[model samples]
Target: MSAYLQAKVVRSRGLCVLSSIGKSVLNRDLWLVTVGDATVPYYPDPESPSTAYPKPKFAYIGGMHGDEIGNVQLLLQFLEEVCTAPREARLQALVDSTVLYIVPCMNPDGYVQLTRLNANYKDLNRNAYSSAFPYARPTTRDATIRNGYGTPLHPEAAWFLTAGGAAMEPETVAVTSWLAAVRPTVSADLHGGALVASYALDACDSKGSINDCPSVEAPLPNLLANAYSMNHKGMRVQLDDTYGDGDFVNGTTEGASWYTALGTLQDWAHHVQHLHMITLEVHSDKQPFGRQLAVLYSLNRDSLLRLAEMAHLGLKARVVDAVSRAPLLAHVELLEPKGMWPPEVEADGLIWKVAVPNMRYSGTLTPVDPGNPDARYPPISFNFTLAASWDEVVSGTGLQGLSAVYTMRARQARRK
Candidate 1:
């Protein structure tokens, strides 16, 4: 099989602007294809006018596992369609406000051999961390894996043993570094072989999942839950009929058969960078490649458009101060632990009244020390509060103090 993509992958002519984000382990050009205009700010800037380009961003990753060919095709199709579609449409309007960053394939070396492991036989997903540099040398069993190419010593094990956690492959290092820089509000990593949306949170082996993390105070996750349902309308039908898990569902019940790998892209994406994330498994039963690819493309089209729209709509807010009885710059965070979606934070540019969506969130406004605005230590107290949405419209005060405890609504959604 040729290392290059043999499929007829043709994206829309004007939709995607492809650029190299970094180089892979073997020095192949790693592309960071963006599907929106570049004039927008990456994060929300309140100082700018209402016409200010909104900084809401959503990231989509595909083919972190090189062998997941379906994801590669799906993402490519999405890039073309979303970029070329009319901006006045709901999907294009969302894309206009939201910035999308996609890494179509993370493991170029592994894809070359049609193998799960990368060039040095490193499993890209398993090997993710700031440390763990210098690709790990495969052990004796690695040679055995290479030999048993045609036959499966159990397909699950074949895929499982391909990589491990904590070791950072070059691609992962580049991707993670970029994630830190972009700090997107919402992100998703595309995977295959399972036809469901998996919101795997911090706990490895998918145990002790929080229905919602209190830190995400807003109704952000709830909005996403509804959005996910809306995007996949009429297709969530399964024998069990249980489509969404609300938040985290323990691994034991949901066929938790895989090994627990730490420092995963999703974990770091949420834990470290504070972005809401989902591991979208597209299709099941290891169906026909062409059929699976089509399913992936179908799912990607709706999901991507929905996410971009949500980011654009969700980022709308105003900041104010508590003591001055005036508009102030404060930090607002929206977190969802169950879905592993990162927190969304906005500072300043709030006016007398702000209309927040029904979604739950831990909202706060902090007094910025003119001396050191970024000072994270010993944060100042005194923020604003409005009991109800109507109250928020009239109140002009900043936050009175720091939150007694950071609260979010991810767990709340799971409970209901």
Candidate 2:
């Protein structure tokens, strides 16, 4: 770890000390870095009328295959910015509530070689699904369309597969294991040389839902993906394809299939540990550095902000519960409300006031099950009992707390 991530060699941006996981086959120490609060209380209050919210966790893994360089730079840049930036309201809020873990380089030996496969020539992503103890690395690239070349014997693969899955490569095992312990809410493995934000959920497969794993929940997989797309849709500075909006597929193949590579990082984090894992392909092989950097910043800015906002809002219910006499960790979804106001009166300085809707339109509430890792909270139907109106909060024993607020422009006000 020291040899590869020497402090002197790395530019001082978001420079956190790297912990030694172990050594590579080529005799290099594997390393990892953890950022944000580790210990925090997380529980739902049943008596409360809303959901209990805790800080969200985000993990960014880069340089896994070695040749994917853009993501490594992006992680470095993010680390620097996060470290130097003052603990303003947003930053502190995210830190206090959310955990951000970044693995800048996964396969250091392979990274030095600048090859898609690690030093052992094994494609790390392919052989990650074995369940047996001290998993074996696949010696063959016959799995997916020969995406890349390499055997499991590659020192990097052997370290993780033969050693204990991710543990085979000391750095990868340490980081992956730590993630399992922390159970981050979201994580993404950064990849390059691809243009789409490929989501490998089990879609159109005869092998019985291969994409449905313990890590990614049903609605959330789509919800988070859509949110990312929506955030980047209109940004003027963003490039055409940098935001990762594209069709969804189970894997990089035409058919869906079940996989069980015991030591795979993404699958381990999601299935074994239950974190929302997304593989983000950051740049194409032909993309230039400057343009790639622009794309990275755009993604970091919007995606991180959205994650923070959702985490913050999720915390709101718990905060409300603390103040109220009754527990408020009930099923509640806050929707932005919209309403039409009567003609506004301009008096003293001719400033106009538009009436805004205090309550949000009612939507279904899903009851969360704490014990079930793969289970999605069932949506509570509310439309049958009440008309969809802008004024009422629309609460029930079934729906608990569903509220929203909407702000309309003054120019759109109607006449009495």
Candidate 3:
């Protein structure tokens, strides 16, 4: 573990360190540091006063590739700045309004060895669950015996493909389990070797070629990518002549459009977890320290805070009982204009529906059985129709700071 990371863990007010499933090959502790509203429970306890509401959750993950030192360093720097600068009003407001989970280094073993893969010689980026390589087997163990000369097979790949008995890699299980538990509204996995914000659908279809599959959560990533690129000076300009048109328009690209890969974290988060996640390729170099680190942090400071605020960019509300005034664990269904899919419902009764800044959509709040034995209320089915124009929900101009918490009341279920 880096001394800097340890120091941050000590000094940061809301720091929670979670140990990865297994120690690194060198036996170093792989830590996931979460900062912000530490008291917020992962799930609402029915026995306790329900604090669950439509607050946005955001995740920032880095160091999936061991050699991507810049990715990890940038996240650490962000954490330090936010923790140390308590008087910074913007950051404090963000913390107050949203829950931020950060996994600073997902591949500590690879980082220690200065390799892209872990000690098992598997690329963690390719270890996630994806539709393209659903049944892919682990070749790392086999490759080791073949003098390390074969296709890489991550432990996660093996576990998913195996019929009945296999375990996921320690790091993979750690991050995946955490994400599934928290279920952030938006997340970004940092990377190096490129300078563009990459959006989801990182893998091709079952046929194995790149397809222009657009995500239903496209607007959120688009807004996030633009915020990062536009805020950073010179990021929008293309200095590298080798890439397309020498410049990334506002520094963003679709993942599969850039290159097809199977089992990437961003795709897994979007497809499996139903979260809006993106891969942020911060810089072209794998490692940049000291002065370079300062420059990187300075450039991305505002963008980082802005992205956190993006969670409030949509319509948010809580579903409650009509007479009892108790929170009801319910499903929010968005009936958008033709051809758009509805957003996923949260585990809590909180509903957050992402709409374009000025678009119109109809939403329905349907109360269903929460299925938890400790739940405050029993499952009842009733629909409350809702219609809203973005203009009504948004408080002001520019979608960044808009937030509304409407308390929707459901009618009692009539006996048939």
In angstroms, give how far residue 201 of model 1 lies from its true place: 1.2
Error of 1 at 12 (Å): 6.9
Local error of candidate 3 at 138, Å?
A: 13
| lDDT leader | 3
lDDT of 3: 0.63
lDDT per residue for candidate 2 within 1-416, as digits (tens), equals 35435452244343344565555557665555555544453323354323423434566777777787777777766665555446456555555545566777777787788776766666666434434322233432222222255433233333333334332444455556567565555566777775333333422212122333421233334344433434443322223433223223322211112322334465555444444565555556623387768776666555544533332211122212122222212243423232211111111111111111232233433433333334333444321111222212111111112212111111111333
- TM-score for all predictions? 0.62, 0.54, 0.77
- Whole-model Cα lDDT of every candidate shown, in order: 0.47, 0.43, 0.63
TM-score for candidate 1, residues paired by index: 0.62
For model 1, state the Cα shift of residue 168 in Å.
0.5
What C-alpha RMSD separates each model from the true structure? 11.1, 14.8, 6.9
- For lDDT, candidate 1 versus 2, the one ahead is 1
Give the worst 10-residue stretch by lDDT in candidate 1. 402-411
* Residue pairs of candidate 3 with colliding backbone atoms: 369-379
> In model 2, which regions exceed 4 Å deviation?
1-18, 21-23, 27-30, 39-54, 87-89, 132-172, 200-216, 233-264, 286-291, 308-416
Q: Model 2 compared with the native: what TM-score?
A: 0.54
Compose the digit string of candidate 3's lDDT tens values, residues 323-373. Answer: 766666675456564444564566656666555655565655566545433
